[model samples]
Every structure is written in structure tokens, then in C-alpha cells.
Target: MANGLTVKQQRFVDFYIETGNATGAARKAGYKKPNPQGSENLAKPSIKAAIDARLKEIEDARVADAREVMIFLTSALRGELKEEVVVVEGEGEGVSSARTLQKQIGAHDRLDAAKQLAKRYGLDGDGELLKLQKEKLKAEVNEMKTAPSDALHINFTFDRRPKDGH
Candidate 1:
């Protein structure tokens, strides 16, 4: 009546003041549910007790943090870890034309795959198709030499495997 809080109410009020979370303080203070009457809810002393408990926990945590900061400051005063640090600033462009170059490079790789398939079909060493393939290979090599370094890597492995031991 004098203040909104009795001595007991003041304790709960103090808890909420410290923790800043009524629900958490309530659970911490071991409050399960309010009494059956709606009037016996958060407006009640029991609920305030729970809130007070949570506030204590928050205060304890803040105290711990303050202690850690003090320790760290003391250590720094004693002179530890003075290594030089370098931080690079970002230029902010992502993947600059990389995909375009990759596709161009991939085209050359596809050509090489076709060449392999041609050989497997026995078309490259005998038919008119074989003559066309040789011309294509020459053009590809010339194009590759002129292209940027990020362009495809072309590798050819010659057969050392013996003909089907017939």
C-alpha cells in the first residue's frame, strides 16, 4: 500500500530489477505456476520471488565478467603478446569473369573428349573423319597457346597398353 510492494514483494521486485527477465527468474526461483486465481499470477509475491532469484544469477554473471576484464587488463600491463598484425582490406568484386573463362576452358576439354571418342571408334586413324580430327587438333593447340592461363589444361596420354593379346 505504501509502495506497490510489501517487504516480500520488494524482494521479487529486486530480483526482476537485476535479471531483467521475469520468466527466467520465476523458473530459477522454483515457481512452477501461479495459484488458481488469476489474481495470484505475476501480480503475486511468489512470482516476484522467482524473478528475484533470476536477478541474482544475472548479477553474478556480470560480476564474473568484470573480474575477467580486470585479470586481462592486469596481464596486458605485465606485457604479453606484442606480435605485429596485418589486416587486408577487401576490393569487393567476387569471382571476376572466372566462370566465363572456365566455360571457354571447358570447351577445349570437350574437344579433347571428342578426340578420345573418335579414337575409340577407330575413326581417327582411318576414315575421312580422321583427317578432319588432325586439322581440329592443330587449331585447338594454336587457340590454347593464345588463350589466358586460367583457360583449360589439355593433357594427352598416349597408349602404352598392348593390343588385346590376340
Candidate 2:
């Protein structure tokens, strides 16, 4: 039994680690005792609970993997941005990564502006901050057309859902 799991749980775990499925793994782990009715007696709640927990672990692992990827990509982009990734108001999510250094980082005005706009709109949009960041990036690039590498500013905004759902 690996990881302090019971023999049965170990089998289920192994199958889960391989196939990432609880019900399927449990079935494969010998939950096939057929009754006189010719149906498998696989209605054990303990087995179901174990499978549910294993599935949750698998899902959590997947989420962690995606978060790592996001960190890596953000770091890479920050590195490319180099000294141009100025923080006019607040810290960025992944701005401090080593592989991707930034320049002219600060905080004050831009952050306040974003907060104000988001507050005004009640901050309800699903990805409003992301959209606002993209717009701010575009504006920063445009403003620095002549000295594009000199610096960049970023702002974030959020929107609230309309009252009537329009």
C-alpha cells in the first residue's frame, strides 16, 4: 500500500493515478462481485468516498499545474518587457519573477485610477480587470510610439452587471 493507503485504497489510488478516474478505477480494483441478480455489487459508500477524494486530489493537481504555467508565462513576458514594465500604481501579479525582470516599477496614480473606475462600476464583470489591463497596455504603447522602449504604464478596471441584466 503506497502513501499509507489500505490495500484496496492502494489499488484504487494506483488506478486513479494512472487513469485519473475514481469510479473506473474502483471498478477495475475488483468491485465486481456479482449478485444472484447478475449485477455487480459495487454500491459500497466507503469505496465511493475514496474515489471522490482521489478525484478531488487529481483536480487540485491539475489546477496547481495550470497556476505554475501561468507563473512561468508571466515571468517570461516580464523578462521581455525588461525595464519598460513600469508600475505606475501597484504591483503586478507576477512582476517579481527572476526570469523576467521589469523596469521603472512604482505605484500610486494608476492604481488609484483603476480602483476608482472599478468602484464606480461596482466591479461586477467576470474579466473586467484583464480587459482594462489590455486597454491600458495598448494605450501605453501608443503613448510611447516614439520611445516605445522607454517605459510602459498599466491600469486595471472592473465593471458591475447591469441592473436589468442587459
Candidate 3:
């Protein structure tokens, strides 16, 4: 019925989509010889085309692409996303009531989003470079503090005789 496939063939495709196992899908679709039938069905051009079209449709409907992922990461970084957590009230006794509380997303989650955003724009290296520069500057300052002054020059003359004959 679907894509010119027979009813059993369409059922096989549907089961294949759900289970991702060809022989299992064939069995579920009531095939007596599931292993060979599954392989035979997969070898059909029309069935493969149908499966490809349906898979593409499913992916387009469900999977998040780059743009969607970027949007999510940006929203998470900006704190625009929120979630509701159910808090259960119970001390040492038994249990009381549960309350649903609305709050901003977790800090670690936001930080991870920020890190991912930074990595996308190649900003993750800035922190490392800045830290290295700070360390180098500190080492230079320490060296300057312990270094001898250039103005304090020392000259050695081994002449012990006076200018006029002693």
C-alpha cells in the first residue's frame, strides 16, 4: 500500500523502522522465513527507496541539525531556557507532598553550553593564552625583584703600587 509495496511489505518496513532489525522486523510482520525474506525485501529497489524516504522524513522531523543545536546552545548560554523540577518533601519520617518548582537551568549545564559556544567560535583558546601570559608576566616580575641593579657596576684593579714610587 505504501510506496507501491504490498501490505506485508509495508508492515515489514514499519517494523524495520521501529526495531532496526531486518529479520526481527520480518518475523514481526508474520514472515515464515524471516531471514531470507528480510534480505530479499531489503534487496528490492522500491522497498529500499521507501525506507530511504521514510528515514529521511523521520530524521527531518525528529533530529536536531546544526542550526537547531546552535540555537539551543545559545539559548542555554543566555539563560533563556528553564525547567521545572519536582521537589519531594520528606525529612526523616515518611513522605509528605511534592512541589513543582520552576527555576533557571543548572549552572554546570549553562557553563557547558557556554563552553560549547566558545569552542564553536574558537574562543576557548583565549582563556589558555591569557593564563599563560599572566604566568609569564608574574615570572618576569619576580625576576626583576631578585635581579641585581645595573647601576651598581663593580670594577677590579689589581694595581697595588702608588702612582709616585713608594
What are the root-mean-square deviations of the candidates from the true structure over C-alphas?
27.7, 21.3, 17.5
Q: Residue by residue across 61-104, what tens digits does model 1's lDDT show?
A: 77757457545444444444243434445556752222111112
Could you tell me the TM-score of candidate 3? Answer: 0.52
Candidate 3 on 1-166: residue-level lDDT in tens? Answer: 5369998999998999998899999999999999999999999999899899899999898999889999999999888999999998886668588899989998899999999988777578886687789999999778877878874454798988898968
Q: Which stretches of candidate 2 lie over 4 Å from their true place?
A: 1-6, 16-42, 65-70, 80-166
Return the top candidate by TM-score: 3
Candidates in order, TM-scores: namely 0.26, 0.31, 0.52
**Residue-wise lDDT of candidate 2 within 7-85, one digit each (tens)?**
7656765675676555676677665531221122124555456666777887987775745754544444344323444
Comparing 1 and 2 by lDDT, which wins?
2
* Collision count for each candidate, in order: 3, 4, 0
Q: After superposition, how far is residue 56 of candidate 2 from its true place, in Å?
A: 1.0
Error of 3 at 159 (Å): 56
Q: Who is ahead in TM-score, 1 or 3?
A: 3
Q: Is candidate 1 or candidate 3 better by lDDT?
A: 3
